[model samples]
Target chain A: MLNTHGLDVSAAIKTLVLILDLVGTFVFALSGALAGAKHRLDFFGIMVLSFAAGNFGGITRDLLIGAVPPAAITDWRYLAVSILAGVLTFFWHPAIERLRSAVLVFDAAGLALFAVAGTQKALAFGLNPAMAALLGMLTGIGGGMMRDVLLTEIPAVLRAEIYALAALAGATVVVIGQLLLLPSAIMAIIGAVLCFAIRMLAIRRSWNLPAPPD
Target chain B: MLNTHGLDVSAAIKTLVLILDLVGTFVFALSGALAGAKHRLDFFGIMVLSFAAGNFGGITRDLLIGAVPPAAITDWRYLAVSILAGVLTFFWHPAIERLRSAVLVFDAAGLALFAVAGTQKALAFGLNPAMAALLGMLTGIGGGMMRDVLLTEIPAVLRAEIYALAALAGATVVVIGQLLLLPSAIMAIIGAVLCFAIRMLAIRRSWNLPAPPD
Candidate 1:
């Protein structure tokens, strides 16, 4: 039985969301392999890094939101796609750098969409605002965090960037809208747009956190 | 508040169990670092792999069972210990390998203890047999599965190993004893010992599943 206390996206919206999710996974996987190539990793290591980066976000989100069995574990399609992406990445890394700027833009778009959608899913399950917001933020930034950790660099979120902050802003908007009894679709659009805008601005401006004094 | 479900461990036994858990984590972390070393990963990568390998199983368990935030995410001490273990492994690969056989034994011991403990926790929370058994199995092998995935290897449990099977056996015993209204501690000890014995036998015989016909 589905929970009745939250908004259910229309078929069209659901289709859009699913498309974005797949796109996010594919790009994230490619990016992961690219990062590994930068470090001169072997093919096996590249695949491992790519797969981990692609799936970690969604896996963490599903477990947190009480989605039993986890979507990644149960759905062979996602696993198939991830494996394919990883394989493709291993063979094609030399050409990826030419599209580095474009790839970052795509990642930014994913962060925006997942933030709002992930939070909405948690809220639908009747979780508290704090938990829902956290899940949303995680869904957006979790993959990148895993990638950075594996790459031995600080997480991009902890560095200077609007990446995670954009997600947080989007999630905050979602939670507040729910509390205010605003329509979910409208709030979703606004929140997503807000995230995209923030992330884009951050990128355009080379925004970064100031280095701390020792 | 802790729910013991009227089953109690003696302070001595409980202390022993905790020590076993730490040993298990250390072994698991070492394995992760070894995987990283095979890939020629950096110190940061080694530490991250170690942390993930050491805690992913219990973290997955707690999250699946609705333990909010999961111990891996919420506990800094666990992260510290796992990373430390990884660093030590990096600096002493030869020494680590010298103790490889002993590590497996400790891991097996942890598997047996944690599997029974997980099942009991689920039963006390009033979950059904199927869910409790699944979770117990997860607690026993989930971390290693995650480690393998991150290292781009097949999960050890899904192979012909006696891993998840032992956990299932333990959980089944617990369920049957509960149905029969048996004493709790007696049943717990029986179930745990049964799992441990089965695992030892499997390792001794080099038992494994046959490869499927292509």
Candidate 2:
């Protein structure tokens, strides 16, 4: 009976993770679609960017952990979310553009969720704590990196400020929580909140990492 | 005795594949280092580019097929080869640039090897023929695409000549050979030769896929 209860808890956590993942996918897809519009890409190009940005992070993480036929490819919900974001942006880009600050907030949320979820997954897959944290950071930044790459730009994570670090900090918290035997759901929520707060602060303050002298 | 012989043959094929994969990595690394040199990146930047261009394709393939801790990450040989190419380019870039045509030929060979090898691996992993062929082409082109993306440029395969198509054609030949139950080594050689020839011809003739209208 105790084992069954534990299994039930695990199942509930999995369901929560799935829902958050989809939400992350949707927000990232919106960012990708907006980038495509900025680049003057056609409908097909917008769709491609949307899909890539929405799913590439999770797909990459899953692949790294030996998850074959990644959920991004096998799950119809991911596709639907990505396509919906693309279509919405394609037709209502002006309205979406007006909401750029809101988009940034949502993007921060996506990053936070992905970072914590990726750390948890990597930990579950038996990666070392350090590697799990790195994978978490990669998950947070991977989608935006792919989006920038496709647009023929240096990845913002490499050139921009405080983004990957925030993700890493959040992921590190999850790893530490795991080490301390905390409830995973609570840790995930705490990690996401930390990451989101950091990102929001960075944006508001226009904080940046130092660059090399010219 | 016959079953033992079959095992010996399989082992031999695996060894050959490993050798070819390393060779491909070296040549692609050289291309990457050269591109970094062209861009005037610092030594560390050049090394990073070399490693990325040498291994990203294989890494991506391995991940997609659930090969964890990808060969590029786990095997020391891949690292040695990439580092060697980077150091060579860092010092002898002028001489290497003078031998640009030779480099192009080597790159073509690398492409051929990766295309055939990737297809064979995908087949061994039980992917359907069409998806296997596509994965093969991705393995052939993925490195170059990563290199270009990091440099903030459009990938040559998408913009310039008949690169990816040749890879696809070679991969398709390998798939067809598998269907026909041809000797694996012989089929690999034939596919590589066909791919090499097509790439060489395209280079000589300046063949290109059609472009969209302005």
Candidate 3:
């Protein structure tokens, strides 16, 4: 087991998480970069938005949990993935926009990955399980929140169908599995798949959290 | 000199900074709560916006510099100030809305305080002078940005006359003073005053950063 902050994570599991993280970052970056394009923001603004959407969630999570110099900032690989996504979107947006369904699918996948990753990290930091799960949800939604805010749109997590709830559900699973002493790898996979399924179902069925009564 | 994270600050100075920070938090919270009221958000939403506007900037800055569990979350005093401001605005919004000019002035003060405080904290953390100054600007404008985004309005910092520029100016002064070995107390005062003066003047004269050609 590869001991990252004392988590008994296997090398293979680490690789899986890393790959998922990179894919998630790329998809989110694409979303943000595309939004910037639609707004006709300049190149620098687009790049900034791309990075914010791709990494801001993890950065927020890390900061709250005391992970100094967040991996998104310190790791060149993460930066590279965001940059690549942004550049690709900038140059080929017309084509990418045609794949809106694909984007939605990718977004669900990203949300699931981020949720579990956030939960694991919070657990590693010894946060209470409830708080850990909340942090996990924040990790999934934070970057998208940043992106929408920059674009002057209501945050999807706050307005969209079952978004933050799905992340919360996934994070809850991770925390519960940890408490029950389940294998970390199995728990993580289950959490991600469950989150993805919830999100996809919400999208398909148009499910939404009820708004407060006036 | 009172040693906080190895920085030499006097008790009097610490008290002053704390007072200013709380005042800033209160003012920003008021602004946020007012926005929430205007938007007809529910009580929960108003409270959330109030806290976000009051504390998110400092939270963002502290996270960037690796301050764990940002004071916004850990410090009960800050939370109390935000809740107080929010509750007041929620109940007495009509009266508060009539004080738009006063709110603007208080916001300027809050911006000034946050800029200098953020700069000082960043420097204490050993960040480079340039980065420190930028972080200061972020601290000044971050909460407002969050508030606006949540409200689906363009960020005032992006559109208002010389807003972020004034913050940058104030932060630069803090950095330069630190490099010159000036007393932290005096330096903070000068930075805040300079920032406030610039912002006030910009508002009065309608000065703004130049926009790129359409």
lDDT scores in order: 0.74, 0.86, 0.86
lDDT per residue (tens digit) for residues A84-197 in model 1: 766666666656677778888887777878889889988988889988988998988888788777666777688777688888889889999999999888898899889988
lDDT of 1 by residue, B1-214 (tens): 2346654446656777666666667767777787777777899888888887778877777765667677667767677778888888789867877888887787777777777777777676566665676567667777777776677655555445677777778877877787789987788788888988888888889865432211
Over A1-214, each residue of candidate 3 has an lDDT whose tens digit, in order, gives 7465876667666787899999999998998999999999988888888999999999988879888788899999888998898898888999999998999999999999999999999899877787788789889888988998888776756544788778889999999999999988788889999999999998999986543333
Give the RMSD in angstroms, all C-alphas superposed, for model 3. Answer: 7.4
Alpha-carbon error at B48 in model 1, in Å?
Answer: 15
Residue range with the least summed lDDT across 10 consecutive positions in model 2 chain B: B1-10
DockQ of 1: 0.07
- Give the clashing pairs for model 1: A160-A209, B57-B143
Off by over 4 Å in 2: A1-51, A64-66, A72-145, A154-214, B1-15, B179-183
Error of 3 at A115 (Å): 1.2
Q: Which residue segments of model 3 deviate by more than 4 Å?
A: A1-9, A42-45, B1-34, B37-50, B57-66, B74-145, B152-214
Considering only N, C-alpha and C atoms within 3 Å, which residue pairs clash in candidate 2? none
Candidate 3 has which clashing residue pairs, if any? Answer: none
DockQ of each: 0.07, 0.16, 0.19
TM-score of 1: 0.56
TM-score of 3: 0.62
Candidate with best DockQ: 3
The model with the greater DockQ, 1 or 3, is 3
Which CAPRI tier for candidate 1? incorrect
| C-alpha TM-scores of all predictions | 0.56, 0.60, 0.62
iRMSD of all candidate structures: 10.8, 5.6, 4.4
Residue-level lDDT of model 2, residues B1-214, one tens digit each, is 2264466766676788788788889999999999999999999999999999999988888777666777799999999999999999999999988998998898899999999988988788777776677678878988988898888876666556778888988999999999999887888889999999999998999987643222
